[model samples]
Target: MALVAVLILTLLSLGIALSGTLTRLLLVVVPYAVFTLFLAGVVYRILKWARAPVPFRIPTTCGQEKSLAWIKTSPLESPPCLWGVIGRMALEVLLFRSLFRNTRLDMGQNRPVYPSAKWLWFFGLTFHWSLLIIVLRHLRFFIEPIGPCITALSSLDGFFEIGVPTLYLSDAAMLAGITFLFLRRLIVPQVRYISLFTDYFSLLLILGVVTTGLIMRHFFPADLLQVKNLALGWVTFSPFVPQGVGTLFTMHLCFVFTLLVFFPMSKLMHAGGVFLSPTRNLANDSRIRRHVNPWNAPVKVHTYEEYEDEFRAQMKTAGIPVEKE
Candidate 1:
């Protein structure tokens, strides 16, 4: 199903590009209009979620929180204060810090689900960092004359200078990581059943984006200058739709736009929602004071006198304490 969907999308996009019926003006107009809707939807959803009331301080704790004066606390794991929470969030966003400590267990014969899995942390780290680098490097496309920062990143990324077209570490790492993640889903029975169309679709979309991009660059080379010109014009609002840009590029661009449009509506909103989540952002000070839900409803209560009135004889016979005889 996932493959069929992608193929259908690819064919449709190629047809659109080849039609020549959709004018340059319309193609240029459509992407930006879609981008606007995408941006608006993202902002609206985020704001709506942010307004939800979290009545209780319910930050998730994995390690020792601030308790006794003598006991040391794991500030990063179980943040007890605001600063600690910020630090934890930073690490999580930038480095996928918590995932570094991830562990997996497997069931064994005559024993509990009691054994090991390989180093998922390393692969996860490699993939994320490489993706970040790739995103940063692409900054050159949307900017005029390309900033020195981008130049520096390009230099550092291809510092090895191995061949005619210098090798990028990110290209290899991204492929390896995507392959592992996909395999992990297919090979693991539990994950395979639980996986939905969206999960598979998202993976395929990203893989297609990366594969098509690589092919465009290393194999069937497109004019980088023209590509950059088109990107910059789009970014600057003085849009220019260039000719001779291949169908593959259009399909890739459409997928990118599709991902962006789908992002806020899907689980990908976790990127922003993470910041607003009480589970990650709140201080864990449960030991320091009490927290009561302000929105809790009033409940009927029976006083001691009423209790005594109801069971006075029984209480006296049983020799139980009574406020009044």
Candidate 2:
């Protein structure tokens, strides 16, 4: 179903471009509209999360927490201070440190056994890095006089010099990573049982984008000058619609816009949401510091002696023993 949906989208894009009816809409309005939705949705989600009351320290910990002066603590696993939390977050964001410890559990002789499963972590890391590189490489189109860093990175990516246009390692790696991830969900019984349409849709959608992009780059070859002009013009608020950018580019752009629009509402929001995750960003310092909930209501307490004093007169009137009297 996901594949069919992607194909239909591709066909519709090609059909529209061939008809030359909505070229301006596809070229200008769609990009702007999608960008607006993406930005607004991300900001709204972030603000909503910011308003949520944590009320207390609840950082997830794995290793020894800081306690006695003589005891050694694992800062990366169980952060006790701000610096330690920063270090842990760095490792988590950059290296996927927690994912590195991914485990596969099985029942062996009535007892559960856990084995190392690092392939998910590896492919996940590969997909993210490759995607980042590809985005960085494409920055050349939007920025005038293309920065030296992007140029150097692009050169490095095509160092193998495989074809006329020089195949980018990131392109192949991204494809492979996506393939593995998608296949794992379909082939693994545990994952397949839990998988939803959205999971499959996201992967197939990206696959469509990459496939169309690769075809344009290698087979048809989009007009670089026209493409760059369009990208820059859009970025600079002066829209430019150039002819002969090819229907394939249009399809690719559609897929990208769809992804951008879907990003904030989907699980892809994790890209920004990770920074705000209390379990990840907060330090495990419940032992050393107190976290009083400022929202708690204050109340007055009456002691047992006060209660007895107030009841003593009533007790005497009723002929009961009164401690106060």
Candidate 3:
């Protein structure tokens, strides 16, 4: 349902743009608005997370701590210091180390056994890395006089030379990864039970974007010069909706705009949130240092002396020992 809705919306957008009435609006104003929203939303979320107080060092530990000298400590797993924390965060951000180490439990002969979930990790890694590459590959469209590095990256991505236009491997990998991820949510009973409309919506939206992009690249083949001109105009702040750009291109842009607007408001904000997560970012140093809650309030208290003084007469009558006496 989510997929159908997004696809319909995208096609509707294409139709609206193709009518030529909203060409300027769709190509110029909408992109500007979406970009502004994306920037503002990302900043707001990051600042919100930054202002949140984490009074304790509560990094999630998965290995041995820095205790005895003879015992080995897993610096990445149970980070005990600032350097260790940096290394851990680096691994998490760059390689998704935690996801790579993910395991699944299965029942066999009435006993549970842990098994490596490498396929999930592979798909996850492929999805993220390929997405990054694709985004970078798009720099050619936005930048005038494309850099050698971008050219090199593009060459590396299309190294397989599979087709007439030289199909990039990242595109296929991205599609495969996204398909697997969506299927996992749908096919797995436990996952399906917990899945929300938003979860499926996000996946479907991305899939729509990828599919439209692939169509434009392989099947329809939009005029690259016109597309680049549109991109360059937007980047330079002198926005102009280029003539002769196809409906598929417009639909692709619509999907991208939708994604940008939806990104910060959805689970996709994990891209930035991961850095702010106390569980992933903090050092596991509770054993080495005492952490006090900075937000703790001061309060008036009744001392033992005050209590003894107040109860002195009652204590005398009851023959109870009193500190005052």
Q: 150-261 in candidate 3: lDDT tens per residue?
A: 9999999999999978899999999999999999999989889999878998998899889999998889999999999989999999988688798888888888888899
Pairs of colliding residues, candidate 3: none
lDDT comparing candidate 2 with the true structure: 0.90
Error of 1 at 308 (Å): 18
Clash numbers, per candidate: 0, 0, 0
CA RMSD of all predictions: 4.3, 3.2, 3.3
Off by over 4 Å in 2: 303-325
Report the poorest 10 consecutive residues by lDDT, candidate 2: 14-23
lDDT of 3: 0.90
For residue 186, model 3's alpha carbon misses the true position, in angstroms, by: 1.5
Clashes of 1: 0
Residue range 1-325, candidate 1, lDDT tens digits: 8778888877777777677655364448877977897899889988997899999988988899898889998998898888999999998888777776665656568665733344566777777788788899988888877889989988988888866577687887888887777777788898899988887777777777788877777777777787888888888888877876776677677677777777767776777888988898899988887988889899799988998999999999999988887
C-alpha lDDT of residue 241 in model 1: 74
TM-score of each: 0.85, 0.91, 0.90
lDDT of 2 by residue, 181-218 (tens): 99999999999999988888899888888998999988
Better of 1 and 3 by lDDT: 3
Ranking by TM-score: 2, 3, 1
